[model samples]
Target: MPVLISGSVAYDRIMDFPGKFVDHILPDKIHKLNVSFGLEKLSVNFGGTAGNIAYSLSLLGEQPYVVSQVGTDFSSYRKWMKRQGIHTDTIRVVKTDVCPTAHIITDLDDNQIAGFHFGAMKYSAIQATVVKHKVQKLVKTKGAIGLLAAGNLDDLLQLAKLYTLKKVRYIVDPGQQLVWLTAQHLRTALAGADTLIVNDYEMDLVLKKIATTLPKLTARIPRIIVTRGSKGAYWYYGKKRLTMPVAKPKRVLDPTGAGDAYRAGVIMGMLDNWDPALTGRVAALCATYAIEQYGTQRHAFSRQQFKQRFYQTFKQQVSL
Candidate 1:
């Protein structure tokens, strides 16, 4: 089975701020706030929703295709993806611009502020046009799953339309891009999707924007997953809803890419046709690995190790 991950492919420049962000800000001056925090360290890593998900899936023994647009400065990231055994032939390269880059600052409380440069990612429709044939080919494969993660609004909508036309199963994760998506855009992107994944806040935003209740939304979409950091996640399918607790991590280093890692786990479970309960557990465990590392694509573990940790965390055996 192949996984088609369509999203941005960018570099994550992460900086660590030693103090809490709230301590330095005045509540009343929020409208005219001016503050700067000295960073402790800065590290540049290969990231982006598509890249991160593909990397984690590859680690789990799935060679997922990354459908994205990158720029001239993407050679290093391309090489890195190849090293990880991910498929990148569908990634289009723009010779004129630089690859998209995300500048992120994280406080001691694991809170983050990020700014992303669209760069080559803005040409997502062009990339989608170029890779239509390749994507269709992959969609024909048995048990192929398409993941529409955070990226250019046009790219998400285009991919969703294509997936629906091809009758392929897919998951829609609006993520940070939800801010820019109108009710109509959200509806269009999520149409015919097999599942919808979002954090608690994002889920709320979606409901508010769409002017619909969870039950009403679930009536259309087969499944909806809302993740709560530290607390756990909720899965809504049909008339039933299931809750899953977070897997305890060895140490929480950074929470930047945990959601992407969790998504890979979810896709893996979907491919295996595992029980939803077990799948949610697997997803939570995968997220634990991500929070334990500072960078998104830095986590690594063998199948055996993953299974062992699953048992340790949830007291249930899992075969990955």
Candidate 2:
């Protein structure tokens, strides 16, 4: 089955501040505070919800078709993705605007403060010819998995409905975009998804909002994964709930794209028809790999290496 990835494609400007942000700000000063801190380090990398997930999935030998909007400046990034074996035919490039850019400043504790300049990404609502063509191809292929990271709400909902009507399995990983969705809209989009993956905070927020409206929606979904950073994740499949431990890493580098990597691992597990417990463990292992890398897409591992790590950590052979 083909993997279709949909979300943002942007450049990440990562900056590291030397000290904790809380040290400089007074709690009582609140709105009257203005401060600037010197950045100890700065670097640029290829990132964004869809790009990260697609890159990780590609590492697992899945050629994911990324459907996202970029700008004229995306040529270099596009070339890199192609070299990585990710299908970029569905990625749209806006000729008149600059690519999306994320300015992220991380403090000593790894807490981040970010500002996003949407640029060409704001035009993501427009349907691209390339995306339509790719979707048509997937329809012909049948049984493709649609992975939605973040995108135009209307477009995502429409695509989800279309995929469900076409019998295509899909996984929804909304990330920060969940804050923008209404309860009813969330229900509609999730109803068609084969799996819903979100961080712990996001899951709590979603559950709180939907509990009053569609109380049974969560139970009706095939699977729901709540990722809890270093604490690991919780996987819900019908009446059973499995808690997976985080894989202990020898060193920590960057946690920026760990969640995306985990999402890819879960998708890989599902494609392999693994159960929820095994899927969560695999996802946790993927996150550990990401945590050991400086940049989101810089990590690479052979299937054998991954299996060895999995067995050493979880004490179980990965089922094919």
Candidate 3:
């Protein structure tokens, strides 16, 4: 079975700042606040929730089908994907003139400020209108798994419904877009997903908004994975709470896309049918690597290297 990655594809423009962000802000300014810092350098990389996940999966030797839209400027990004052995045939082009883009700035302390322009990403809603046909065509040979990463709100809801209608196993990962969804809309998206992956902050918000217990929140969904920054991750399913320790990072450069990297590890684990404990450890290791690099796609390691890291961190051999 092929894993379908449905979400945004864009260029990530990263800027490096030499000074701490706190140096420019005044606490005694009362209500006035204005500041700007000169950037030391700028680097562009192929990234987006979908692209990041697909890239991570490729490192693990999984070829995920990315079904998303790109703008006219996607030439280089497309080239990179093909070269990386990711399945890009399903990628569509937006009718617009430019592709989606994310601008991020990281300070000396590794704090980040990011802004996203949904350029080509906006076309995802239109793509959702015909996604059933797309799904049908792709799954003709075997069942396909889906991970609905962050994108247009309506597309998220529609794709969730379509996946449920077809009974395709899927993971719902709203990411930062969770803020754009209403409680009712969130419930709709969660109704039939095989699993829901959210960070600790999002988990707290979802619980508050949905007004439900941990057990009740996951009643319809089989599993809910909550990631806590340095503490590690937790999985709630079938009246039990499971925990996985963190894979210590070599160095923390940027935490921008660690969550997506973790999700890629989770998908890989699912494909291999690994135990929950093993899956969580794999995800934690992926995240550890993600934070060690400035850009999401910059984290790369061979299977042998990853296996060695896994054993060193968890004191157990890779079973998958």
Give a tens-digit lDDT track for model 2, residues 95-116: 9997888888888787888888
- Give the candidates in order of lDDT, highest first: 1, 3, 2
lDDT of 3 by residue, 106-158 (tens): 89887777899989777664354365466567654456788999976666787
How many residue pairs of model 3 clash at the backbone? 0
After superposition, candidate 3 runs with Cα above 4 Å error = 26-31, 125-132, 139-143
Choose the strongest candidate by TM-score: 1
What is candidate 1's lDDT per residue for 32-57, written digit by digit as tens?
A: 99999999999999999999999888
Which structure is stronger by lDDT: 2 or 3?
3
Clashing pairs in 3: none
* Model 2: residues with Cα > 4 Å off, grouped in runs: 211-215
Go through the candidates in order and give the clash count of each.
Answer: 0, 0, 0
Residue 1 of model 3, lDDT score: 78
